[model samples]
Target: MKIPFSPPYINEAVIQEVNSALESGWITTGPKVKRLEELVCKYTLAPNTLCVNSATSGLMLALKWYGIGEGDEVIIPAYTYAATALAVIHVGATPVMVDVEKDFNIATHEIEKVITKKTKAIIPVDIAGWPCNYSDIYAIINKKKELFIPKHENQEKLGRVLVISDSAHSIGATYKSEYLGKITDITVFSFHAVKNVTTAEGGAVCINLPEPFKNQDEYNYLRCFSLNGQTKDAFTKSKAGDWRYDIIYPGLKMNMPDILAAIGVAQLPEYFEKTLQNRVEIYEYYHTFFKTKSWAILPPYKSDDKTSSCHLYALRIKDISESERDAIIDKISKEGVAVNVHFQPLPMLSLFKEMGFDIDNYPVAYNNYKSEISLPIYPQLTKNELEYIVSTVTNAVESSL
Candidate 1:
């Protein structure tokens, strides 16, 4: 009974959609891509949505759109995957690292402490599909509005710190009974293979800017930005006598093609109807199995105001060193269960270390990382597989202890 971690939910419907895309001949940034964007807007209730090749690119685009650049600072959680920090770095901005709360979200007080005149944006990550406290974060941003010094047009228009949600793990999750995308200024969702909704390798940027900043206008500009600044996509150019186009700004080649978008198109309906429900059930099962164990620190998946997408069951073991946790993971693997760590804090990684970041500075992030094990929580896992996973993890933890 070999159990793999987080496989994509690819049914016959997904294959059929891909087949239809292949047969259409207009496979690159065509109708399917537009359709996927529409479906995302309809589901998330965002004012506008733009599909991109990856969430990294979406973050970069958001940063660039806000005019975040050299000498500017962007606040991010040290506990997140490197992509969050890397996006800031790619835009030539400094990533101001902050410690996370016990629930694996950026500390709002920490955010307020580090904010300066140079702070341009705050990228709060929804670790393991659990949303951060947006109401508090927004209040903090508004409280610090006088300190903001806008460097560009968009920055001036926004008049405060931008909140670009690193929502790669939290598309279907809700914050305060509202979907994540609409709750923030801008939310980026990943459709990577292991995500709850996959497009093999794709992402979407949802825009929900306030008055005086038209979301449709922003969406249009971002669409062009994703396509190397071309005024028209290949699909539009393919139409009779529509070859004429213009290069507006030097942009990135990050647009999603129809073929990949097809996967998301097929997956969205099933995701809302069944896939997310299955993941919630699996999450509950894991919680029920581990609640009695004193060593078990269960990941938060549901609350009165928030409901997780159940992306990762990031269970933590108590009183274990980092080395001990690694040993437990190895033991579980040997027993034919595939488990993983959510992340090593940025300061623990080689890149941030050379940049003069110390893991000790982010004690909470390091503490969270040391004993964490991400269990499989996907739509495809069977009941037998779920039981096997818990039993295997329990044996490994007790033995390691």
Candidate 2:
């Protein structure tokens, strides 16, 4: 019984959507992309959304739009993927790394400790589809508002540090009965091949700024900014005598094409009721099977106030070293079960190590990484496969111990 990890749920409906986009003869950032953005806004109940080539680009675009550049500092959890920190680096800003809690989210107290006059943003990642504590983060931001020094007009308008949620793993996830997109000032959702929803390689930026700052105006500017600052996109220029346009700012080419957006359009309609529901079932199955095991520590998915997207079933083993965890993964693989680690702490990576980050400083992140193993939790897995995965992981852990 061979089980693969996180394959995109591409069915006939997805194929038809892509075919329609291919046959339309207008593929680059056109009606389909606009339609996806509209669907995302409707789904998340956000005021506006901007589709980009990737989540990394979306994060960078948000940072640039806020004028967060050299000498500025943005706070991020050290447990997240490098893309979170890389986005800050691309904008010439320093990424102030902080520790995560046992629930695999940025510690709000750690965020408070790092707040400084140069702090411009706080990017809290929703690890493995679990929503971060935005309410606590907001409280910290409010308490430290006096420490924030606005450098740009947009920054001044915002009045305090911006909260950009690295929601790559959490699209349909909810907190306190509200979807994740509108939870923060800016939320970036990834549609990579392995995500809950796939656009092949795309992302959407949900804009929900407080009043005095118009979200629609920000969306319009970002839309243009994504297309190399062109006043008119190629699809618009294709119209009769609409070729004349102007460059507003030197922006990056980060717009999503119609073809990729087509995939998301087809998936989102069924996401809540079907796709996400299936993933949740798989998550529950794993939890039920592992809850009885004294050696197993299950990841959080549902509570009274939060519901996860169930992107990854990251299971941690009790009392294991990092090398022991690696051996267990090896054993699982030998049984034809594919598994993974959510991430290594950023400081453990060579790039961050060279930047003076030490994994020892982020004990919780390192602890989580050492014993963690991400099992497959996609909509396509069957009951038989689910049993196989659990049996295999149980055998692997017991043998390793």
Candidate 3:
């Protein structure tokens, strides 16, 4: 009855895809990667999509493209994974840590207050597959339109603040009838093993920019940037008598390999309704079981206006201290049910604390951290296994208290 937390749902199909890729000699950042990018665009309905090695790379690329550097500031929720904030620092910008709301996502109402003249971008994280309240954040951005400085002094007004979404936990999520990736200026998706879909370790960046970037050349430039800023891709260079090329810029190498993309391509057609539906079933089961427990503050279900990917089933123990939370986690593990914490808040981590970030400043994020626990939620769990998990959690929580 031992249940592990967040196991990768790999099967024969994934193996078969990998085998096909191995058979094909051209496996490094080739046609398969290109095909996955195209499928991602079609699924998300984004203007353009670029596949990368990981979501961390995708975030860094987005920030770099937006020209966020030294003296620039990026606003992000303190409750997210460290990678979200680390990506900002990697771009040589200061990450202004902000408190998240009670739901473990960005504090939309408080974002406007944090916007300063040096604010170059706002990275709102979609925690545990729940999309942040983008409408409110968009309202704040729209009202502060005067704060934006155009790329050129007399050119058409382009918004200075880029709305980059850290959508690593939310690929199938929807916001206001549109997919999460298509809703933001730049949205990044993680296809890590434990994610809803897996490319072993991969991600994609989808851009929804308007106006000046409407041309195809703009998309081509983005593709070029992912491949060491080369004028042409390896696929193009492999063509007859096309070996000659030129370097455009000093770009980083974060291209997705065809071997990884082969899994993605095979998984895409089977993913849409099948993978998500299984996850939804798991989520709904948890919801039903936790309904009678006053101590359990269940994760949000899909509303008429929005839908989550149900990536993680995070349960909060009402009125519990941090010690109690830790004890509960220990008890669950002892009973053969592995439980985990979503995050510990960036300001509390050693590196961030050494960097002079104080945890007391973000009370909501700390409070969320104190009581939260992420249970096992994946596509492979059977009815018996799910019941075992529920009973194990129930026994653990009651005994721990």
Q: What's the lDDT for all of these models?
A: 0.95, 0.95, 0.86
- Clash tally for model 2: 0
- Cα lDDT, model 3, residue 327: 88
Q: After superposition, how far is residue 214 of candidate 2 from its true place, in Å?
A: 0.9
Query: For model 3, what is the C-alpha lDDT against the true structure?
Result: 0.86
Alpha-carbon RMSD, each predicted model: 0.7, 0.6, 1.7
For model 1, give the 10-residue run with minimal summed lDDT: 269-278
Q: List, residue by residue over 191-246, the lDDT tens digit for candidate 3.
A: 99888888999999898886666625545766788899998888789989999999
lDDT digits (tens) for residues 1-401 of candidate 1: 89999788999999999999999987899999999999999988999999999999999999999999999999999999999999999999999999999999999999999999999999999999999999999999999999999989998898999999999999889999998899999999999999999999999999999989999999999999989999999999999999999999899999999999999999998898888899999999999999989999999988999999899999999989999999999999998999999989999999999999999999999899998999998888999999999999999999888
User: Which residue pairs collide in model 1, if any?
Assistant: none
Give the residue spans of candidate 1 off by over 4 A. none
What is the per-residue lDDT of model 2 for residues 1-401, given as tens digits with 9 covering 90 to 100? Answer: 89998788999999999999999997889999999999999999989999999999999999999999999999999999999999999999999999999989999899999999999999999999999999999999999998988889999898999999999999999999999999999999999999998999999999999979999999999999999999999999999989999998898999999999999999998897698999989999999999999999989988899999999999999999999999999999999999999999899999999999999999999999999999998988999999999999999999878
